[model samples]
Target: MSKFTSILARTFLQCRPMTNVSTKNMNMLSLMKSNSNPINRLAILSISDFNKRHKSSATSSLADKELATFLQDEIENETKSMETKATSPTFEGFNTELKDAKVILTKKSGKESFKVIFNVNNSLDNNSEEEYSEQKNVSDNKSNEDVELGSPISKPTYTIELEKNGQIMAFYCSFAEEGSYEDGNQSSPDSAGYSDLYRIDEISIYQNEYTDDSYSVTCDLLDEQMYEKLFNMLEDRGLGNEFASKLAEFSTAYEHKLYVNLLSKIKNFISS
Candidate 1:
């Protein structure tokens, strides 16, 4: 018999006289004394199962505590790292407006006003070293200087609209990360003498607005000289190489801020 059964037997014998016990109660006691009896086996099995469950629950609780601590530390580190890495809120003389995933900037030049619109959703991508170096040139101002090469940065297809006397000329533009200015057109007389960054992909001239039926003229259809003139038209209005670099830095910083907020949400969920 096990030590527990032996102790049980001794306790029962010492607790009462054998002559006073009923026969049925004595039979039950006899069955309990045997390890092979179903009743006794069930009792032992139940105690073992209870101990295992208790141990598992304790281990799970400990793991949860450790995970919570790790998340908290990570949150703190990311928050501190981004404290000074905010994107510049102001972009020269333009009035800035943010709506969800889109950023709108508007500026007036003499009798003409222009709007630059870009979307942040699905715009971020890993940047090459050459492009990253170019982006750093305009980081001297109020925003996003901490982003390094090979990091995820904003590469958006944006739109610029120049309006004068109720007529609007819109340029659908993209950035050329590599080998765009090798044609010796970098010093084009119409250019703002800024670095070659922005590219005019398409141009559309509309009156009173853009409708579903409006036509867009692709830059590929235009000659090199015409394209250069169109590009310079935008550069003169402040959407030049410098603005391109600053906008990229701003977008990177903005995306990082969003990422940190997401991390914070995850941590809160786990802790809760």
Candidate 2:
């Protein structure tokens, strides 16, 4: 008989009724396997079925573990990217009012830079008349300065904070100076009509695991149009030969450092 038929015959014999009837036993005996006794064949078939079921379950468990690990790694990478993006400075869509303008020259790089702060006092003045009048003189002076310069100085100042591998290393401000027109001749200290100039201050670079060294870098003012053009070029394709050329035009070490830091952050984000 075929192996399938043999296994089936053995199962029927082993499961037959316990009652002893000579004629029934004779009839059942006719279904026995050709080579093996009924009991032995039945035992082999039961063991084989059990092994097949066990193997199928083990394979399923292994596949589940592999899938779980893959999902976990994907989640971790996504979380890191989100956190980095949250902390990093974005050039676009920034809005803040600039105030308290000052100029400084860095000795290390021999570059002149401007720094400014946000006009938070104005918001408070808007709510309180007394506060508004008290601060009016300061505001008037700033307005006069703007008017004398013949350009609206309403742009917001932004502070750039730098970090390496999730630790803040330095902070600096981008500022603008009002140009002066002396005796009908435009005689601004920075001959460039650009109101926006960035200055680097308060730098802290890590010297070791437990200590940090601080230094200040100077700023070199760039023409507003040239600055914008360079910014656009970098935005299109960041920090390559073309961008480097534009950066070279900036004579100040502080300016170079700011541009490099910004470029590095942008490149890392894009590649990620």
Candidate 3:
């Protein structure tokens, strides 16, 4: 038998115990069982094709060993520096429930009940950090020490709802990165208010029952005073500047933990 055919047979035997082998590999192995010179028939195949066809066995290759080592180091490094937020344990009077990537916080005050929802998926991104850095230079030109806000945390979208009696009012809100003001004028009506804060996008009111037909009014249509009043209402409910900052921090920590968990899962899968 040729050296190439010998290698192919060894690979076939090595992966035969793996129940997850691809159909293509199984077909190739079956062809080898019937063919006299499987190597000669597959001679014209490029190196890339061979690598792709045998990717399952390649998990034990040297490249994967290096990758596994790198992931181990990365996971350790991230875990060492990880600092969870105070909200991770509990956020004030609101009870927390985590459903996959989404976080739902609920609380009741007097006769009104509130629900706040946000998702951690794609909430923390390096691209936004770069954009915020550029904007900071253009707007204030302050040193990192002067700013002290650290990397732009999460600019996650949040859905806040209030229920009173039999009516529900929902506010769709989003976090704005600090130092993201255009024209360096935060008070400008065109701006989304001062940076590093959450702003309301739209408001919808409906009966206790909600459906797809519910109508929402965009906050842009509201006058300046009306907008401020709406924002202040949220502030009174503990969703103000301090809460926004803490939310960003908590989101960053939560997202990073999720990422590390994913990395560990992938590492185990490849090693197996």
> Which regions of candidate 3 are displaced past 4 Å?
1-60, 83-89, 125-128, 131-152, 182-196
Q: Candidate 2: TM-score?
A: 0.21
By descending lDDT, how would the candidates be arranged? 3, 1, 2
The global C-alpha lDDT for each of the candidates, from Candidate 1 onward, is 0.75, 0.38, 0.75
- Minimal lDDT window, size 10, model 1: 182-191
Off by over 4 Å in 1: 1-74, 84-86, 128-150, 179-195, 269-272
Index of the highest-TM-score prediction: 3
In model 1, state the lDDT of residue 29: 77
Which residue pairs clash in candidate 3? none
lDDT of 1 by residue, 1-272 (tens): 99999999999879876897899998867767777768777988799999999999899878877887887888787677577566554688889887757889898989999899988777775455356666556554537556443346677878989899999999888777544354433323344644566677788989979998889988777887777787677677778778887887877677667767777777677667
Higher-lDDT candidate among 2 and 3? Answer: 3
lDDT string, candidate 3, 49-145, tens digits: 8777688566558778998999999899667646433336457888888887898989999999999899999787566678668766754765545
Question: Which has the higher TM-score value, candidate number 1 or candidate number 2?
Answer: 1
Estimate candidate 2's alpha-carbon lDDT, on a 0 to 1 scale: 0.38
Which residue runs of candidate 2 sit more than 4 Å off their true CA positions? 1-119, 122-158, 167-171, 180-213, 218-272
lDDT of 3 at 13: 93
